[model samples]
Target: MEKRNQSAITEFLLLGFGDLHNFKILVFTLFLIVHIMALTANVLVIVLVGVTRSLHSPMYFFLSQLSLSELLFTSDIVPNMLWLILVGGGRVSVARCIAQFHILCIPSAAQCLLLAAMSFDRHIAICRPLHYATMMTVTRQLQVVTSCWLLGVILALFLYTFLRKLQFCDLNTIDHFYCDVAPLLQLSCSSTCTVELAVAMVTYPLLLSPFIFIIVTYICIIRTILKIPSSTGRHKAFSTCSSHLIIVCTYYGTLTFIYLFPPTDNSIELHKGLSVLYTLVTPLFNPLIYSLRNQEIRAAIFNYIQSFKKWKAEK
Candidate 1:
């Protein structure tokens, strides 16, 4: 019976901001621009970090990895969102929905680990500057980044193992944009106790542990900064990690609200709004925040522009 029911529903109708009938075109245009800008900005960051010898440190390496993850994250969701806006919601096959969820989860999980690693890097750079070089060597940087990606893949697969077992019956409408865990579970007819439990087990630790780790790491960083004899030194040290701290707060804040609090029937719209913040707006802002705030990134961009101009003149 469950098998038959699951087989009956081949597709789900994602009700993505369908209520914004008056603003659909406006919203679509905005999202399209955001998507393009996010892709361009992240790509630019990755390219600069890759090509610029000055950005070859562990911090910049992690930044490039972050750009890669954001690039993938936005690519996975924003285009679908644009389509939804244009068509006023869209039909997605069950398989496609599942794939979307996994793709989304992989970056999300990787980002969590990556942020923690970044915080640890800052901690070492600030708190133990003398050993920073030996500690965060090129080989160790690769190991840490590889671990983040590998663990992300493992975690997503673990969730997929349980999610694939869920059976959806007659209902095929997902309230929010894309195939999120909460909405999919709500749509399923099967007893989702195990699935819900699995999600909680995975989500709480994945989110909280890293969050706690980052908090503790930042505390140490702050202490180190405070101890700096000169105000300039303190400001310089703080500047090094401020962009990352902002990204961490924004990313975790929105994610916590969406996942930990799971939306009530009345709050689905609010949920979608917060989802947009993290999914669309956050990625768009990340590269901008880093580039605008960090002197090194600005210098890299300026140098590249000069090089381009000289090349064109020679040609």
Candidate 2:
């Protein structure tokens, strides 16, 4: 009965980059631009923090790690996706899809955890200003970051093992731009309840816990800001949080829209649009979000440009 009713999905057909034969290059160019922007911005953030002596603090250090993860996370999807849309066929083999899922999924979850850690750092600075340096010591930040990476890898392992057992029997076409959990699981002919339960066990905490942490941290931050009794003080505190809130809202809003609701017929178009934003747009926005007001990254880029100019003159 199991084999009779269930036909395994050998591969998945990803419907992405739209269907204009002539515009394929244009679409590829757009994605390529986003990719290059993401890579350069993220790598610059990492290098700026890593090489700069003044940036050897808890906040900048964590930001560097996040940059590294985002680099890996976006690279896994966008490059392969661009190849599929621009030149190669969009069909992904089962094995390849499985690998992509694990790689993409882990970092996605880890980003949420890392964001929560960042929020905590800010909360300490805002709420308990006197103890900020001591509380957010380098050792503590390292532990937080290390924990996020470990949890991400472990959750990915569980997802891979759990997904391996399920049999996919329905249509091969994936509606979203990328290989997402819910959409991929939709085609399963076998027991999805197991997959659902196991996944919830791993994912719900990663997503929701961070949300809760951010909320709590900000609540304290806001309270502390209120007690400051000075307009300039309040404004500076608010400005610090505004950037992170924007990023959190953008990332979590799109992610929740796709993952929270059931895949109703009306959601198909919305899902595709949101997937593009979450995957590509976030990569574009992360550096802008974290680095624009950041003097360290700006100085790092300036120094690099100066060196390159001098080297050219020497040559």
Per-residue lDDT tens digits for candidate 2, residues 1-315, read: 133354566988887755759888888899889889999988888888888787787777878877888888888888777877875457887677778888998788888888888899889888888999888877888889999999999999999998877677656887655677786677766777888988889777777989998999999998899998889999988877787788889989987887777577787887777777878889879888877866666777788789999999999
Q: Per-residue lDDT for 7-90 in model 1, tens only?
A: 568899998888677888888888888889999999999999999999999998999999899998988998888888888888
Error in Å for residue 139 of model 1: 0.9
True-structure RMSD for candidate 1: 1.9
lDDT of 2: 0.81
List the candidate 2 regions with Cα displacement exceeding 4 Å. Answer: 1-7, 87-89, 303-315
Candidates' C-alpha lDDT:
0.91, 0.81
User: Candidate 1 — worst ten consecutive residues by lDDT sum?
Assistant: 1-10
Q: How many residue pairs clash in each candidate at the backbone level?
A: 0, 0
Q: Which stretches of candidate 1 lie over 4 Å from their true place?
A: 1-7
TM-scores of the candidates in the order shown = 0.96, 0.91
